[model samples]
Target: MNINFNSEDAGQIVIGAFALSVPIAFSEESWHLAQTLPLGNMALVVLLSLGFIALFAYQSVFQANVMRRIGVFWLRVAIAYLLTLAVVSVVLIALDKWPMLHQPILALKRTLLIAMPASMGAIIVDSFDKE
Candidate 1:
């Protein structure tokens, strides 16, 4: 059965999935932002939600259109990783925080952490019945 996926619904699903992590991100980001701005928790949640949705949207589109072969899937994932890295790198640079992620271990860890939630969110959205 073909599903007419609305991007708007997907975004709402993403934010709803932010449940268990809200407190964690809120506490951590609040601590970080205490040194910076007002509305820190709200801002942190908004940023996290947007980032989560963007990654989900990217992965969903790629995973849907890319060839289903195992090798092709990995290649698609690698391209997504590079794109995410470039986007994140520019943001980190703009924010003036640079660390050593030159090694595969650290880089892979970072990518997987960012990717897992988005992957889960996409799965959740796609599996929902819309009759």
Candidate 2:
């Protein structure tokens, strides 16, 4: 079956996924299956790790598309960079749960809380980039 994970509603999908993940991950109910759900302070680290992986993937994909658009133009590069920072930093990261990421990356779950959203957003942009 086809999945529309790349539509305008995809943002809502990511947000909804995060919302569901947070409570289930930290709660004891998750213990019925795996040891973690994907939230809570401890689980945050894993989220961070996943987020980094997602970021790297998104950047690599994004750069390729950006290069295709205006590889030789520094102006485009700067604009893309600033836009990316603006989108990931302000729109998504800074909106709801940035405080959670600002917390010391001392744990797993907390890290994911910060990183996953970053990665997911980046990936979304990458997907939207002209191919």
Candidate 3:
């Protein structure tokens, strides 16, 4: 498939991220998980999220045609993940869950945990309507 990253794609990603993030952001388990989970586990979450994004990007959008549009492929993955991270960060900040000033690591852990599912949502939405 010929995938073009466009404004509508961004909007879809935002909507998808928000759809999954709000529920997870409100979870007490998520809050505590972030506070207690080790840094290594969080690193695994990051890798897992990226892996899923890359897999989907290759299967649904790039379709083994990535070499020709490497920039667009990377852009889609980056935008989906980063946009979801931004959305997750805003939600956590509004909920007072992100204490960046005092406990930056915990805050980052929370964001990464939440971004996993949220970024998955974003990628799924990005793949919509492409046959």
Segments of candidate 1 deviating more than 4 angstroms: 1-68, 99-131
Error of 1 at 119 (Å): 8.2
Stronger candidate by lDDT (2 vs 3): 3
Off by over 4 Å in 3: none
TM-score each candidate: 0.32, 0.26, 0.93
lDDT of each: 0.40, 0.38, 0.91
Give me the displacement of residue 39 in model 3, in angstroms: 0.9
* Cα RMSD of predicted structure 2: 10.1
Better of 1 and 3 by lDDT: 3
What tens digits encode model 1's per-residue C-alpha lDDT throughout 25-122?
A: 33434334433344454455435645554445345544344344446445433443344344333333344332345544333333233333433443
In terms of lDDT, model 3 sits at 0.91
Cα error of candidate 1 at position 131, Å: 19
Ranking by TM-score: 3, 1, 2
